[model samples]
Target chain A: MSSLILTHTRYQMLEQMRIPISWVASAFFPAASMLAFVVPFAAADPVAATRATGSMMMIGAISAALIGLSITVSQDREQPWNHYLRTLPAGPLPRFAGRIFTSMAIMAVAVIPVLVIAALFTEAAITWPRLLLGIGALLAGSVPFMLIGLFLGFTLPSKAAIAVSQLLFFPMCILGGLFLPPQIMPDFVQALSPYVPSRGAVELVWSATTGSAADPAGLVMLAVWTVAAGVAAVWAYRRDEGRRFA
Target chain B: MAVLARSAEVTRRYGDVVALDRVSLDIRAGELVGLLGPNGAGKSTLINLFVGLRRPTSGTVELFGGSPRDPLIRRHVGVTPQETGLPEVLRVAEIVDFVSAHFPDRVATPELLDRFGLGDLAKRQVGGLSGGQRRRLAVALAFAGRPKMVFLDEPTTGLDVEARRTLWDGVRSFHEEGGTVLLTSHYLEEIEALAQRVVVVGHGRVLADDTVQAVRDVVGVRRVSLVAGTLPELPGVLGVEHADGRTHLVTTDPDRLVVELVRSGTPFSGLEIRPTTLEEAFLAITSQETTSKETTSEETTSKESTHV
Candidate 1:
């Protein structure tokens, strides 16, 4: 079983490598945001620069975990090859694990550009242990987004998945305060920021990297969203299975 | 021989449409059975049921004496669906390896590829393959697991003669090694080449299940064409059609049909009696089923032909 999982993961990763542009895009966006926003405005303030860096990393993780993963899943569902694999005696576990592992690897790779920019040009300072903690938090924060991706992928067709993931992505990024700090946003926007999954995700990163007190509401909502999305994702998978095979 | 797969009184309905109705079949070990049917005749549906891709609306489908829905039962079976898409970026060899990994025992990648005439294209990406090559790859993947039984649904649908011959060789070799096979095809010659027994399906029902020659004899229809204004009611006439002032009569026994026609005192000329090909035999059998359903309100049995 372990060998099957490993084989699936290796082949999936190899498939992704065949098209490097998507991976490059995930890393590029976060670094570009860092160079444009952080280098000029918050370079001198250590705490501000560190928080901004964390938010940028959140953008990268969301791209990989939410948008990229969803699109790939929906597309995979449309393929006859995927249906054939499901018919195999190994069951769905190996393929499911392989996809999740590959998505997490993408999430990790996406954060590198943000990390490099922070090290080179910003006053974003962190100890080695804190850096490790921040990485751990980043993965944890991505869980809700990954689940959301799975939900969209299983429920929607590929064309709708591409459109809806993007539609959900931009609004959530802005409303979640990834682009601007919630403190500086207008009253209405600030009130809504704590509820979005992205805000909760970035809050964990901020607390880990900058030693800031985390927002309790944000963490609690993150947990709520994770559970809800997990339920929805499982339901979507079962619905798809019923439609195709039952 | 032990039965490897069996479907008992299986009926599958899609809304009001009966895709498969009261179909029962048994595929024994070391037997190469061909499933011959027209489009929407439930050949694909039967294959889907055996592979556990779809469940029958009524009745039971078994593989290896267990439920086909069991993944363990599926472990001993390999399947190539009617239409398949391979991951475009993966090489031929990689795709084989990935599928092979799912089974406990598998054929070596190189040997499997070589058997399917894909040895030289091992490094080629699937997207780079031609339509025939891609089709061959899709068919070849079924054997990668070294399964005891293989289900191939139209395995050579879009292949050149050479490619089709190469695929036949691979399937023949597998059957020679005592591998059970059940394949569906629209091509009669394909069935004649590989299958020792043929099961004919029409209108979601089994019309004929016999050896290739026996199926031909089951229909045994002959075309008797002549130029005539009209013909009297003829004995053993299954179907009659008129075109360009010429009458064509289809019947099981042309000898009996012609004697009755002449006895009727119908003036006719340009008489032609041609032995029907397997394709014509198949068409006659399936078309007979349709006409029977349309003419009678009763549940139509396959062998009962309505005289027209």
Candidate 2:
């Protein structure tokens, strides 16, 4: 299983390096967004700007995870590799773990440029403790969304998966508080927002950046969603087994 | 000990359609067995079952001493599937390397690639290769792991005559090295040339399974043609037709007819004798089976209508 995971990770890294599109979006998007924030409001407080910057960074990571998982998993299904993997002794678990791990690694690399851009553009606090907390919060918040991506990858056809990912990204980001502060929403919307994966991630980011204790209720909800998505992914995978490339 | 290498009494169904129905066979080791059938004869399905790609709905598929899914059994098995599913984005070398990783011991990629005439194309993307090249590469991948038994589905579908001969040489060499091969092909000549035993399948069942010569014998007739100067009415002859100043006789014993023709000293300029081909036997078996099935269905339908 470990060997399979390592092999998958190696392929994923090689594929990412070969494709320029992913790097362009990963490096440029957050930097461009940060520049927009800094240029417009030079007088904004460093702490507030950093909080907003961190939320935007979280949004970028979530989006990347969604897109990456959908495209990669769908392509894998279309290829013979999925069938070949099934014939292997390791079975689907190793392949699934490898893909998830690779996606997480890619998402982490994607978050780096955003952090750098935020540091350069705004008077955002770049203390070691805050940076650690920020990175941890971003990763934790990404879990539910990544799981959601896995669900989408497993259940939907390739074209539908891409379209659904694109369609869901912005609406979820807006409702979940990645685009706007969750507290500013109406009470009914705020109540419903906790169920959305992006909202939970945004709240985690908000708490981490603002030095607030993590939202226990939101964390629990995210965990439930993650677990539920994981179960669905396994079911989908089993159903798809022996069907591809045959 | 029994010479049979594997046996199956397998059935598989997809929703309401029965893909296979109690299909049973015994394939002996070191014998190249041909699975001959038309489309939808469950040829692919049976191969899939042998490779552990699909679980049988009922009954058993035993390979060697155990099921096909047994890792110990699989270690000695290789399959070149009908559909070439080589990864398009991967280079030839990478694809070979990736599949080689699954085997217990590392395969000689460079030698295998060179043998397949893919040495120069190692760095070329799989999608860029021609169809025949892709087929050869797929076959080469199957050969790399040195499996004790190989399953090839229509192995020579996209090869030129020369390439086909080359592949035949490779297959002969593998068998010479004491490997068992189960092959399926639409080309009767290929089966006749390569397989010592042939299993004809139709409507998800084994219509006939025997040696190539044994199958021809089942049809029990040969065609004998001689010049029209004089022809003898010989016993055991099924029928005779005169055409184009020659007599053609369908007979169970062509040797007797030939003896008679020579003794008569009837100014025969040319005499040709040909045994029934596998193609004729296969067509007779499948068509006869289909006709019987149609009659049974009709009888049942008429009886039901009468009762109603």
Candidate 3:
């Protein structure tokens, strides 16, 4: 199973490597955004600037997760390559593990530049501990949403999935403080925001950058959402097991 | 002896639709079995089940005496789906190599490509190839793992006549090398030419399973041709058509008719005697089913009328 997972991971890496433009954008976008902060109009507090930068990184991570999972799963579903894969001796574990590993790897690459940009542009104290926590939080935050994308890719029609992905992408970003600070929102909205996976992820990122602890409840909530989405994906997969490419 | 493949009471359902209704079949080593069915007849579903793409809702599907999902079984099974969609960006050789990576003992891909007439296109990207070339490439990929059991769904769909004949040779060669093949196709001629035994599926059920000759026997074979000049009235003649100064007659005994015609000194210009093709047998069987269905409906309707 481990070997199969590794094989799938390798396949995903190869697939990502094939898309040169996407790779370049994912690796460079964070640095470009960080440079934007150098303008005089930006807020002076390095912690605030770092928090904002971290939020942008969260956005990139989520987008990467969505696009990676969506395209990979959708193409597999559409072409029904899984049918061929499933016929092999490797079983479902290798195939599923490969997909998850691939998405995670893409997420990892996407997060790197954001961290680098945040480290460079902000005068806010950046400790190794904070960096690790921020990375961990970002990953945890993206997992559930990525699972959501997986569900859509597996369950929805391709056109509908694409539309929904586009529709949810910006709204989730806006609600999670990608373009604005959560603090500026009305208290009721802010209170409601953490339930959103993006909001929880962004908060985690902010906490990591500021050397503060995010709401434990929010992290727990994100974990729960992730678990639920994962379960849903598996269930959806099993229910439609035999009917692939039918 | 190679176990080849086996399925015991394998059933698969999609919500309210039963895609395969309690199907069971077995093929011995080196035997080419044809899965014949019209659209939505569960041929593809059965192939998917055998290949472990779909788990049976009930019962078991085994390959080489092991569970379908067993790695040991998978190592020996190769599949080519009806819809061949190889990665467009990858070269034919790269596609073959990528698939080969999964198997510990991969076949020499160049040899398979050469056999499939794809050696020239090995370095060419799949997207640039014609439909038939891509299909040939897909078959080469299936052969790369040197599987003992191969499942080919409509294996020769887009191929020209020559290409199809070449594919038939490939299939025969696989059997010669002690490989088992289960093929599904709507093309009856292909099945007749390749399969030793043929299984007919209808409404997600196995309607008939027998040797190709046995299936033709069950369906009944007869030669029919147009005879010009004096018409001889005969019993058990299934059909007669009079057109263009010729009388077409379908009879179970063609030799008897030929002798009769010769002895009678009948002047017949168009004397064609052809054995019953698989297409005729299939049509007869399915049409018989439809006739039975219509009879049942009529009986139900008449009973309702009596009640009224």
Candidate 4:
């Protein structure tokens, strides 16, 4: 099973590399936003810059995780190659794992440009251990987003997946206070910010980078979103299987 | 011979639409059967059941004497759907290797490519291949696993004469090596060329299940042709198609029609009558069966539409 999954990952990654546009599309936006927004104003202050950098990284990861996976998964469903894969005796597990791993790889690639921009242009400071811890947390936080991507991909057509993932991504980013610090946000948004999964993700990154305490309520909500997304992803996948093949 | 696949009074429905109406079929090992039907005659639905892609609403489907849902059975079965889009990025050899990995045993990639006449295109990306090339690759992928039984659903729907012949050669070789095949196609020539037994399906039921020659014999319709400036509605004309300066009419009784034509002084010349070919047989069989079915169900105000 693992060998098949590894092969699937290798092939999927090769397919993505051949396309190139999908990775570039997800990678460009957050890095562009970082250069345009974070590097200009937030760079002078070390703590502020680090927080902003963490937020930007999550933004890039979210774009890759949500929009990228959703679009690719939906598009794959429209292909006959996917049908052939599904009918294999090994079932859909290897392909699904391959896709999830590929999404993670894309998210990792997307964050690199943001990290480079922050390291070069900003005063954001981080110890090696702190950076490692922060990277781990960010990877963990991306699971819910990946799950949401799967839900969207299996439930909707490719065109609708593109529109819907984008629509959902932006609202969550803004509401989670990724664009601006929660302290500077309006009272109502500040209150709602901690409940959003993106806030929980960014909070973990911020805490790891700056030695600040993570928000317990925010972490709990992130866990909740992860669970909810997990259920929805499974339901969507099974529904797709039933509707198309059964 | 052992039964390779069997559907025992299987019925399939999509909501209110009954796609397969208690259809029963048995495919024995070493048999190359042609599932000949017009669009929406339950050919695909039956294939889906045997493939374990869909479950029957009633009765049962078995593959290799076991349930079709068994992966053990599916592992030995291969299918090429009516339409498949091969991975655009993968080279032909890589696609063959990747899919072949699923089975315990498979044909080597190079040999598989050569057999399908895709040896030169083995290094070419699927996206760059022309329509016929991609088609060859798609059908080739089905054989890579070296399955015991193969299903080709209208495999040559859009291929030209040469491409279709190439595919037919590959199919014939597979059968010669003792592979069981259940092929569906609108092209009567394809059926005549490959299938020894022809199963004619209409209105979700089998109209005729017999040897290919027997099915052709059952059609009974004859073709009549003439070069008339204007052709009127005639008594026995079942279908009309015009080409060049002449109109072709298919009918059950050409002698009576010709007599009527002579008595009416229809000013027709260059008259000829010919035996019905497989195309006319299929059309007549399917249309006749469906028309009869329509009469039986005509009283129901709300009937399932066959548009799809």
Candidate 5:
């Protein structure tokens, strides 16, 4: 089973590599956003620059987790090849794990440009160990987004997945305090921010990199959302199974 | 001989639709069985049951003495659905390798590719391949696993004559190597050319299950065409239709009819008596079922009316 999972991961990653433009598209936006907004405004202050860089990096990783994973999962369902795989002895586990692992790889690739820009142009200062920890924290925090992606992918048709993933993307960025600090947003929006899973995610990243105090409510909400998304993902999978093969 | 697969009085229903009635079937080892059915005749549904894709609404479907859903049973069975969608991004060889890795034993990638005549296009992406090529690849992957039994649902649906023959060669080779196969096809000729045992399905039930020749015998249709000016009252004359100034008589015994014609001194110069082709035989058999079903339904309606 381990070998099968690894084989699935390798092949899925290779499949994505064939479409080079997708990688560029994923890495492009957050990096472009950093260059546009952060390079000029937040580059001088060490604390502000560091926090902003972390937010953008979270933005890139979460986008890959949510959008990239959702679209691929939805499209895979439409293929006959997926039918064959489900009929195999390996069942769905290996394929599911492989897809999650590949999404992580995509997340890693997406954050590179943001990291490079932060290091070169901004005065964002963090020790090597802290930077590595911040990266790990960002990935761990992206779990809910990955589960959401899986849920969306399994439940929606490919065309609808595309539209819905795009629809859900920006609101997450805004609520997570990626674009602007929650403090500066409307009072109601700020109060609502702590309840959004994204805010919890970026708070973890911020604490790891800039020593920001984490919000307990946001962290608890993120945990709740992760569990909720995981259940939905599994439910969506069974629903798809019943519809197609039952 | 051991049974490789069996369904015991299986019935499958989709909401109000009865896709398969209480159908019982046994497929023995090393036998190539052909499933013949018209559209909506439950060929795919039955295959799905055997492959463990769907559970029977009632009754049992088993493979290799175990439920097909069991991985141990599935490890030895392979299937090609009616239509396969190959992942477009991967090259042919890569996809083959990916599939072959799942089995404990497999046909060598090169041998599998060569058998399907796909050796030259190994590096070409699947999206770039023609529909025929993709189908060939789909069939080739089924054999790649070196399965003990295979289910092929219209494996040659989109191929030209040469491609069909090439694929038939692969099937023949696999069968010769003692692999059991069950296939479904609209092309009766394909079944005639490949299947040793024939099973005909109609209206969600098995109409006939016998040897290929036995099923053909059950059809029992012969065509007797001759240039006879006046038609004679003949024995075993099922129907009479004329074409091109010739009387075409449908019958069970053409030789006897010809002998009768000769004895009666019916002035016939151009005489032709030939056995019905398999296609005609199939139509004759399926249409007979339709007629019988209609009669039964009419009887039921009359019985209900009497009660009213």
Candidate 6:
């Protein structure tokens, strides 16, 4: 079973590598954002820079976990090869696991550019152990976004999936205070910030890297979103299977 | 012979439409059976049910003496759906390897490709191949698992003569080695060339299930053409059409129709008689069923064409 999963992941990765653009797309935004916002404004302040850098990392992770994954899943549904694979005796579990692993790999790759930009252009100083803890927090926080991606992918066609994920992403980032500190944001936006999954994710990273206090409400909402998204994703998958094959 | 796959009293309905109605079929071991039907005759639906891609609304579908829904039961089965799209970026060899890995016992990628006349194209990307090559590759993938039974739905639909012949050879060699096959096609020529047994479906029901020769005899509609003005009503005439100063009559017994034509004493010229194509013969059978008023209520409401 492990070998089968590895084979599936290898081929999926190979397919993604051949395209190349999606990888660039995931890495580009967060790195560019760091250069624009964090370098000029927050570079001199170590704690502020560290927090900003953490937010930038979440942006990179979301690009791969949410946008890229949803698009690939929706497009795969339109393929005859995918349909044939579902009919195989190995079933859908290996392919599903492979996709998740591939997305997470891309997510990891995406954060590298942001991390480099933080080290070079900004004073986002952190110990090696703290950076490792932050990275672990980043992956844990990405779970809800991945589940949300699967939900969108199964519920919509490729075109609609692309449109909807983009529609959801920018608001989640801005309102979650990834660009500016939530402390300075307007009162209404601050109130709404903790409700979004991204706020919980960025808060987890910030506390890990900058030694700040994490919001208990933010952590609670993150868990809430993960459970909700998990249920939604499973429902969507079964619905899709019934519609196509039944 | 042992039945490798069986569908007993299967009925599948989609919303208000009945895609298949009380359809029962048995694909025995070491036999090549062709399912000949018009568009929307439920040929594809039956194949889907047998392969466990879909379930019967009523009745049972079994593979290798077990439930088709079981993955282990399906391990000995192979299928190529009516339409499919391979990942455009993958090479032929890579795709073959990917599919082969899913089976416990598999043919080597190179050997499988060579068997289907794709040995030279193994290094080529699927996106670069022409339509014929893509089709051949699609059909070839069905045998990758070395399955005991294969279901091919319109396996050679868009291929040219040569390409179609190549695919037929691949299927024939498999059957010659005692593999069970059930393939669906709109072309009777395809069935005649490869299948020993032919099952004819029309309006979601099996119209005829017999040997190829027996089916031909049953649907023996011959066309008789002559220049006759205002011809008399002829016995055994299944259909009639007039064009270019000639009246063409399709009938089961051309000899009896000819004798009747002569006894009527109508002036005629340029007389000719010949066997009709399968399409025309199939139309005759369905029309005979219709005129005799044997159609169920659901059949009359069916939007599917009875003609090929």
| lDDT agreement with native, every candidate | 0.83, 0.72, 0.72, 0.81, 0.83, 0.82
Q: How well is each residue in A40-109 modelled by candidate 2, as lDDT tens digits?
A: 6631577667777777787778777776687667766655545544544345565677667766676677
Q: DockQ, per-model, please?
A: 0.33, 0.13, 0.30, 0.22, 0.24, 0.32
Note the chain A TM-score of all models in turn: 0.92, 0.88, 0.85, 0.93, 0.94, 0.93
Q: For model 6, what is the error of residue A209's alpha carbon versus the real structure, in angstroms, after optimal superposition?
A: 3.0
How well does each candidate reproduce the native contacts, as fnat? 0.51, 0.08, 0.35, 0.29, 0.38, 0.44
Highest TM-score model number: 6
On residues B1-308, what C-alpha lDDT tens digit does candidate 5 reach at each position?
99999999999876556778999999999999999977666787788788876778899998999997776678898877323467788999998898888888988888889988899999999989998988898888787788999988788988999999988988898899999999988799999999988999887799889988888778788888888789678887767888889988878888788888889987887888777766666777777787776323332322221110
DockQ metric, candidate 1: 0.33
lDDT for each residue of candidate 6 in B154-239, tens digit (9 for 90 to 100): 78988999888888988998999989999877677888889899888877889999887777678888889999789998999888
Model 6: per-residue Cα lDDT over A1-246, one tens digit each: 887898799889879888899888888988899899999999998888999999989988877778877888888776656657766777555776688788888878888998898899887899999999999899889889988998899888889999999999999898888888998999999999999999999999999998889999999999999999888987876556322322
Which regions in candidate 4 have their CA more than 4 angstroms from the true location?
A183-195, A241-246, B13-17, B55-60, B65-72, B81-84, B160-162, B222-275, B290-308
lDDT of 2: 0.72
The TM-score that candidate 1 achieves is 0.85
Off by over 4 Å in 1: A35-37, A183-196, A216-228, A241-246, B15-17, B81-84, B223-250, B260-277, B292-308
Instruction: Write the residue-wise lDDT of candidate 2 on B215-245 in tens digits.
Output: 8888677878777665656665666779998
DockQ of candidate 5 compared with the true complex: 0.24
Residue B263 shift from truth in candidate 5, angstroms: 14
Worst 10 residues of 4 chain B by lDDT: B299-308
Instruction: Output the lDDT of residue B44, model 1.
Output: 70
lDDT of 5 at A165: 94
Residue B119 deviation, candidate 3, in Å?
Answer: 2.8
Model 6 TM-score, all chains together: 0.86
Query: How close to the true structure is residue B275 of candidate 5, measured as C-alpha lDDT?
Result: 74
Backbone clashes in model 6 = 0
Candidate 1: residue pairs that collide: none
Residue A139 shift from truth in candidate 2, angstroms? 4.2
Residue B8 error, candidate 4, Å: 4.0
